[model samples]
Target: MAPEARIKILLKNGATALCAGLVALSSFSLGAEAARRHYRGHHHHIPQVPAAPPRALPYPQLPLPFEISGAQYLPLAWTDVKGWSDDNHLAAYKTFRASCKSINGQTGASEPKALGGSLSEPCRVAKTLELSDDAKAKTFFEDNFAPLRISRLGEPDGFVTGYYEPVLEGSRTQTDVFNVPVYRRPSNLFVRGYKQDSVSLPNKGPVYRKIGRRKLVPYYDRGEIEDGKIAGRGLEIAWLKDPTDLLFAQIQGSARIKFDDGGVVRLNYDAYNGYPYTAVGRVLIERGIVPKEEMSMQRIREWMAQNPDGAKELRRQNRSYIFFREVNLSDKDEAVGAQGIPLTAGRSIAVDKALHVYGTPFFIEGELPIDSERSKTPFHRLMIAQDTGSAIIGPARADLYFGAGQEAGRVSGRLRHPMHFVMLVPKGLDPSVRAAKLPVPDPRPSEKIAKLFPQTDPAKAGTPAAAAAPGKNETVATAGPVPLPVPRPAIEPAREPRRPVKNRSHRQQ
Candidate 1:
């Protein structure tokens, strides 16, 4: 379990996986071709059947260059209210999910003009709704969806999910891969959700919230599972071997949009997540990637035809889907000064660039008063920002993704306290915004960690920390006064590059 050994192993596995994927790609031809199927997870008793097998989701997949260990998450507020089941209503949900997909250009031309609304001008049409993937998704929407505008066919109930290549991606390269930014337009249904407190917008800007069951059970992929911990539930996910771009669309809400432009107005959710898919499609269309009337689906194919690399990303985006119930983490404890990994669960805050960007190495020196259901308690120490959630949106505000079960639920429900904390940003970033700088008197003459642990030579400590230990996040390699490992690229060669080979001892000859 030494750090160097771990790093070497991680290096070996990663290199091997990359080589395998590259080899697979070279051998098998990849494309838009696919068969669609009705998936009923392992628990479903139904026979497996394919209605239309998806060649793949429409967005392309461009893998991130390096592994993202942990970044603090701002969380949203949501919980499954009362009774909800997907088994009974899947057929109905399929219809709605299908309708939204079809209407939003999942498979056809996105009808920007449909339903009388546009991002520039609040469309007067009924807001769209998306049923969940489960059988009941459709039925639930039918019962709960409330639309302001009547559907062209009849009446609409608000419940539409817009699927777009998160603008950060549709527009740039290093995309917010998991983020679905554009749920751009919110109809009256959304207004209702916001107003009734069915949904809560975090006071802080755009950080994410942890989606959890009422009990804050953490969601973990099998590989990340620890023996005694319970894993969380969410959309099943997988990484496509090849990068690809797929279908994208926008499903609007009922709130009437008021554009800052003012000439025409429609309610699109303030680009909270990002622009709606419909909005992005319009922008892309205006740019002439495809005709205004061309189905965005096929156009995506055409776009891929023209931009081969992009084609992969488009497909990748479409194939993936997620469902979340953001929770509040108010009751947990905070550890300061000690080297530790943070849980995506528990209360958290986001800072602006002036303060600290996500992923700052954190150190809390003073007491962080806990809002206990019982009595006051102070817990603080060193913890790395591991994840960011949806509710944490603003530069100052943040969602507290509550970690697990009834206990976490009860504690998180009431958590809110101010604590003195400090952070270490990627060097050169202004630190005033994070927390007042921590003081370290100049490396006093001969003051080194070697003085603390004489047997653990500083020279031996210089070896790369092993990255092979996949389950543990990072080994806190400290050289004494430096409690946390400075994120030195030089120190992490496994994640970066190998050092130069040492020359043989010529004197030995």
Candidate 2:
């Protein structure tokens, strides 16, 4: 009878035990045959039995809610977000719409590699909706996106600092009082590892200067530039009163240069000196020059003013320098961000571009010292990732952009705090569905292959018998204990004979 027919017959007759016994006998026979061949020295090649394929899982393995480098994401409901309902969604929606313009422009090959095409559907839906009502705007976000608590992988909370457009009095041309020059990008400056004469500078990379036809060196640092290294190169766009104002403007990345004749020139970040940013405020704290609680832009300015030489020394410690380019904007317009659009004060935030998309929305909840230096006002709002800064790194780090002037600076300067971060991921990238489809991992081979290999008992690991067992590289004699040599006693026969002879001579005398 055929194997199938026999199997059916056994099942019909209820001979399941006999069938299992036959399978066991067959496995034992195969194993015995291989051992016999080895003992007989037949030298016949024993064919390797391929391992059995892993059994299929009844359910798929679950996956994390989202994937962001250096970050972990936990799925959350909209209700879980603190103060979500009270936030001004309309304002956030407007900023989101502005970023969507840039997002929509990136299609086909121009899509961002990090986020890919995940955000396109949401951007399309946003463009079709004319959301005037705040309730409708909130509904749109709820329907199209999912909220996830995002933070740095090992960190428990997110951190935020603040920046603003510094308005400093200046002149278009260098004058006696307004002598410190605010420089434009130098002609010789280029990104390192690229052609020196390239038409445009890349958005990201270390920048360098072409010394000659074949040599490239780091671009002039803040100290070198301040000391007039590139003075006669006609790189000055405007002139500020002191180096202190210029340094602050560089830290902010943009400034409104107001002339004595009432003309205002807008200068935005063009390039940088390719050195790592060192926060002067942090240095002050480290050196015990400024207390951590009193470390703010206003305080730093006061300290700098009191000690001019120390200020210059502190400024030189931050070697990274920023170059500016003129932007055509009216006096009423807010300062533009790295996204090439005018920023929304209190709504726009600069996030780590390496880890997040520009158009992403984040809901931040925390108490901040906004009202006063020591006041803790609740700061719960929806913020848009519309810009980036060198200092703003990591998945959960952000820099909040306030508007221009002294009041804006005061509020922004005192805003370094920890907060809760909830990222709004679009519905297109459904993490739950993706997680459900993930396959379970294969089982370990320890149980299946255990009998074929020699096993060692954990309880006898350090015993003499276990230690005496030869390893792959050891011989039996080498692995066993070695006998120690015994020392011999010293002889004293010659001294005893000499003492006996002396006693005999004394007796004869």
Candidate 3:
């Protein structure tokens, strides 16, 4: 054959082989792409890759006048919630449902204390269920809500105090025996801007009284009120025997008045004098009179009895004063709290209404130093935010209600333990809405993101790009950069174990 013809035939065969290989490679790529799309569309039956443990995120701190300062939180998984499975959620469910009437009915401007519009769906879901057993209630709560562990600044624990409804011996009219006067909301007392003030604390709104023609001034303190300031106003509700009992009763916010004739009446918190609350127990601790670990209301009362001469001055140390309104206790044995609902014995808790809404569920774990055998025992349960107090200041702080009478008082007065708090917000409502209220800067910015998207302005690099990274947990917002979702780890397929071959040649060998 000719040399030119042979070279042309070799070139033609090589070209054909190259074209066949390219067609096969393109077909294989297309097949792989189709399989991936199919897998994404139908993934329900397939087992999901186990999620990595949730990383702690920086929660925003309150910045407004109404917000509790320095209070923050972090998102935690259900497994992170201690004693979650052990709690009797049915008891909590009962307490929560009691506040639903008030919560669901609530309208107008959203108040800080009660469940407003956000709780409507959860409340409705609760109303439909029978919730007869503990298991069902537990499941309901777990399915409906996610837990957020609350902290102050960065610390996970805070002080847990206790308060209770007191039962006092009193008379409607002032007598020789019953001389101490329990005053009503004075007629002369006025609030700033409004003709009458309805808010219970100074922080909620400014409280004032009309002194001159049009001038408004802060209402009188405990000292002035005890003197002659509210003297001839005909505002006295009832008179009690002991002055110390009246003082403690004011701090507790409610009292059941028992008469010699065996009849009883209730007095609930109506108004305050706008003065900041000073805990006398705290006063004793600061003065070095009583050690903080040993200080309790029972001990304070005993100290006051021992030194009657200085009792008057010590009682006056707390400038905050409480006024009461006569409430009928015919319907229920327990006193109605600030939420206008009957407070449960161990289930109710008093928090700063300015910080938390009423009917909100809080899971607390702490040890209470009550007088009974159960004192200094671990208490892990779900409690409802039923009331508010002057001294309940922070987001982590709470005053647990120990029911009524002397036993309740004994338990309540002695409790001064550190507690862990986990707030349960309603499901479906974006918790980021609350977090967005006060945008917190990321404490530890992403070093990887910062280096990748290096900022021209050195100052802005940590503040912007590093914060916007997904796993780094930046504050959620509409305007800021949307974080790219973290890619999940690829899962390998399962393989069958190989069976070893049997050795049958030993006898023949």
Assess each prediction's global lDDT (C-alpha) against the native: 0.30, 0.83, 0.79
Residues 1-509, candidate 1, lDDT per residue (tens digit)?
Answer: 99999999999999999999998876554321221222333345666676886687444453322111222321111122112221234432332232232223323432221111111111111134343455444334323322111111221211111111111122111234432221211221122114413433322232222334223222332112212122123221211111222122112111111123432121111212221122334445666766664524334445666886555443333222112221222222221100112233232222222222233323232222235444555443322232332222222222233333334434433333333333322222222222234433377545675566434446655566532343567564434543557676665445766799988887856
lDDT of 2 by residue, 317-387 (tens): 99988888888773449987777778999999998776788888999999999999999999999999988
Error of 3 at 334 (Å): 0.8
Give the lDDT of residue 182 in candidate 1.
Answer: 19
Clashing residue pairs in candidate 3 are 113-357, 113-358, 114-358, 190-208
Off by over 4 Å in 3: 1-69, 112-116, 197-206, 371-375, 432-509
RMSD of each: 34.7, 20.1, 24.9
**Whose lDDT is greatest here?**
2
Clashes of each: 137, 0, 4
Q: What's the TM for model 1?
A: 0.20
The candidate, 1 or 3, that scores higher on lDDT is 3
On lDDT, who's better, 2 or 3?
2
TM-score for each model = 0.20, 0.73, 0.70
lDDT of 3 by residue, 1-509 (tens): 99999999999999999999999999999999888778877864566889997876665345342234577776677788888887889999999998887888877876544234566677788888877999999988887776877867778696787788888899888889998899998876776655564645343454678877788788899888888688767988888998899999998989989888898889888878888888888888899998887787888999898987778898789888888888877366788988888999899998877677788888997666654533677678899988987777788888889899888888888877788898887765445555456765664558766655544444665786745656665653323444669999899988879899887776755
Rate residue 502 of model 2 by lDDT: 39
